[model samples]
Target: MRDVKACRVCRSPLPRAGRGRPPAYCSRACQAKAYRRRKNPPVPTPAASRRPGRRRQIAEALWRIAAERGLDAASMREIAAEARVSLRVVQYHFDGKHELLLAALAMLNADNERRARARMATVDVDDPRELLRAILDEFLPVDEQRLLALRVFAAYFARSLVDPELAAVFLHDGQPLEELVATVLTDFGGIPDPRREADLLVSGITGLGMDVVHGRRTLAEVRATIAYHLDRLGGTGKVPGAEAPGTAVV
Candidate 1:
């Protein structure tokens, strides 16, 4: 039996008669109108066909390839293959591997910053404990996605160390976190040399992240280690050791 349906052309609530042909239009006139409309469908603009957008699609392809196979494998041909686009298309968007990697780095950094900002949006910067916690949380790879991002960082940073041009860009991007660490230390660490302490803390946290990523240590261990160091810095409020906040640097 034909099921109940609306007329395709007029949508006039036409019901199906028992054991009859399905109506494409409400009436003969509606059917003629529908045929005319079909023959003159509006043509979509070029921008409309660029739905997801080419630049984003290329970035996504490169990011996915780098994440899965490491940056070394994210070549122009490989990225083009991954995105199901031609090599010339990929090259049209990005000049070469370095430029592609830089774009990826920028995207990854922006994503991380966006997430961290959202997470710390309501954090009390004046509160020493809260500030320190937020700062540390931003650095920690608490989830698998974050750990994957770290791999991207590792790839670029390693390359940057040897290439001064890349190093300049990398260092500039890294300064914000370093400054944040310094601020937290100055306000909470209770140590005289907050700048030095900040550097040390950053170094320590970086190592802890490495261990966690390499599976040598767990997230629990990382937290424990951080807490231990923070306590030494007297982050709870007052300095704990025999050192004064100004005179004796703990």
Candidate 2:
């Protein structure tokens, strides 16, 4: 005798058959119900799908504290408070404050990089001046988001001076940003010494960005300064009567 089978949906015993293939459902209704279930699955709960990780929540709390009150204020207990979690929860996610700080920096850098690329995608990449500007713009406090990032950057830079671990984060890219600037200068800007000009441009923008964060320089003043340097480096490659580089800040 052949072994009996149960319906996949209703668990009813399937009728024994004499043919080569055995049926899965006892009746057409059961088969149809199973098919319907497969076609239209239940939706997942919003919390189940959209919940942020505990580590990220803690890291973001650090970012907010760093931006608003400097990194010194971002103690473990303070971070947990900012995140509305217990201090033990913050400790659970990060081994220590150093690790949490590094994570926040990494996340900030990654987010800025992604946004910079997105911004560049909307522009004409063949225009080297525009491309370079796009890259440099990411470093400046052009808007609220960049403003927060620059604050964190300034705090980290100061701390990195005495802390080897934090300093490593600054040096992680191995001069890649400078190399990219040099490439753009050589290929499109047609500068005589691309590498030298790249170093100057990158450092100049960084200093100017920091100045803005310090409240010593206005955004307009920094743009004018940047425009002056771009003109001097011959990176602007401007034609007669064309608008000046960095004139209208993005």
The lDDT for every candidate, in the order shown, is 0.72, 0.77
The number of clashing residue pairs in each candidate reads: 0, 0
Q: In candidate 2, where is summed lDDT lowest over 10 consecutive residues? A: 42-51
Best by TM-score: 2
Clashes of 1: 0
**lDDT tens digits by residue: candidate 1, 129-202:** 66776778666679876887776677766777778977877778556666777877777644667777788778
Badly placed stretches (over 4 Å) of model 1 are 1-53, 235-250
Residue 237, model 1: lDDT of: 37
- What stretches of model 2 exceed 4 Å from their correct place? 1-52, 235-250
Q: What is the C-alpha RMSD of each candidate to the true structure, in Å?
A: 14.1, 14.4
Best by lDDT: 2
TM-score of every candidate: 0.68, 0.70
